[model samples]
Target chain A: AQTVTQSQPEMSVQEAETVTLSCTYDTSESNYYLFWYKQPPSRQMILVIRQEAYKQQNATENRFSVNFQKAAKSFSLKISDSQLGDTAMYFCAFSRYDNYGQNFVFGPGTRLSVLP
Target chain B: GAGVSQSPRYKVAKRGQDVALRCDPISGHVSLFWYQQALGQGPEFLTYFQNEAQLDKSGLPSDRFFAERPEGSVSTLKIQRTQQEDSAVYLCASSRTRNSNQPQHFGDGTRLSIL
Candidate 1:
């Protein structure tokens, strides 16, 4: 079974500052995918960034980037120049394809508040 | 639709009542998934579908939960004799392929309340 862990339960960052949310997972598979998703108060889950285990280059999307360390099973999300819109509950996710099918798992989530 | 769409946005049902939630995946998506999101928690996988075929349903907590995608586009999740424990936000997601690397597009979700 695969599981994702988000160590930080809640975090706050001042507007225009930077913040990083840590995530780690337990998985034996070498080839997998990791993702960070944002769920606003409206409860719509939006994809923030994603990294493929086979790719060493980190994934970056505008102000959002991920530091993916495959060997360490750690994938963290960094938000630069954070804006108030970044306030949301962030979740770390993992998925891998196997014989039966693809299995997806999510971490507990970290509530982030971007202060003005 | 431009994105995955789910309805009704909010559903409130008394205990023991049956409920059915609908999802309209992106037109060409080959895979669809259903998840249950509890308050202050991450979404938990409930079932998976590859087109019209249900490939995995191991995440369904009990027999009362059932999901189907008859046309490989619109999917429905039905809960029979719902209990208070089943109250949560039901989410639907779709992907371009069966590959796990593809990022899934999600719907806003239907908030299910079993009183």
Candidate 2:
């Protein structure tokens, strides 16, 4: 079975600053995908960013990026220029690649607060 | 629909009552997913559907839980004789395809409160 771990239960960052949320996973599959999802007060789960295990280059989506260390089994999300809107519950997820009906294993989550 | 849509954004049910939650995936989407999110916890997969065919249901915790996508567009999750432990947010998501590479689009979840 695969499991994702988010060590930080809560995090805070000042507006305009950068923050990094740590995530690690345990999976025996050589090929997989990592993802970060955000859930705001509205309770809508939104995809933040995703990284393919086979890609050596990290995935970047504007201010959001991921530092994927395949060997270390770590995939961290970096949010640059944090804003108040960025405050939300962030989750790390893992999925196996090349599988039909792939299910995701998610971490507990990290509540982020962006202070002005 | 422009995005995934879930009905009965909030549901309150007494213990032992039967409840049904509905989800309408985006048009042309081939994959649909259901997840349960407990308070302060991340969403956990409950089931997956590929165009009306339930391909995976290993995540369902008990036999009381049932889901169906009769026409491949709209899906429903039914919980019979619900228990307090079944109280949680039920989320529905959809993707263009069943491929793992595609990102899923989610709907505002239906919050189920079992009393």
Candidate 3:
């Protein structure tokens, strides 16, 4: 079974600053996918960023990026130029190559607060 | 729809009551997934459907939980004999394919409260 771990329970960053949320996972599979999801107060789970284990280059989406270290089983999400709207609960997820179904195991989550 | 849409944004049910949450996946999507999000916690996988075939349900908490996608487009997650612990936000997501690399688009979710 694959397990994702988000060590930080809560993180605070000043607006316009940068913050990184750490995540580690336990998975034996070498080919898999990792993702970071953001859940706002409205409870909408939004895709923040994603990284493919086979890809050596990190994934970047606007202000969000991920530092994916496949050997270390670590996929960390970095938010730059944070805004107040960036405050949300962030989750790290893992999914192996799925031939049957698509089910990803998620971490406990890390609550991020962007202060203005 | 442009994206996944779930009905009954908020549902309040008395203990032991049965509730059904609806989800409309994006058109032409090949996979649908249901997840439960407890307060202050990450969303947990409940079940998954590849088109009209339910390929995985190992994550369902109990037998009382059931889900179906009769037409392969809309899905319904039914929870019977709901308990207080069943109170959580039910999220529906869909993806173009069942591949692990495909991103899953999510709905806002239906908040289920068991009193």
The prediction achieving the highest TM-score against the true structure is: 2
Give the per-residue lDDT digits (tens) of candidate 3, residues A2-111.
88899999999999999999999998898888999998888888899988888999999999999988888899999999999999999999989766556888999999
User: What lDDT tens digits, residue by residue, belong to model 1 across residues B1-115?
Assistant: 8999999999999999999999999989998999999989999999999999999999999999999999889999999999999999999999988888788889999999989
lDDT of 1: 0.93
Clashing pairs in 3: none
Candidate number of the best DockQ: 2
TM-score of each: 0.97, 0.99, 0.97
Report fnat for all candidates as fractions from 0 to 1.
0.66, 0.86, 0.83
Categorize the docking of model 2.
Answer: high
Ranking of all predicted structures according to lDDT, beginning with the best and ending with the worst = 2, 1, 3
Q: Write candidate 3's Cα lDDT for B14-48 as tens digits.
A: 99999999999999999999999898888899999
List the candidates ranked by DockQ, beginning with the highest.
2, 3, 1
DockQ of 3: 0.78
Tens-digit per-residue lDDT, A1-116, candidate 1:
89999999999999999999999999988888899999999888899998888899999999999998888899999999999999999999998854334757999999999999
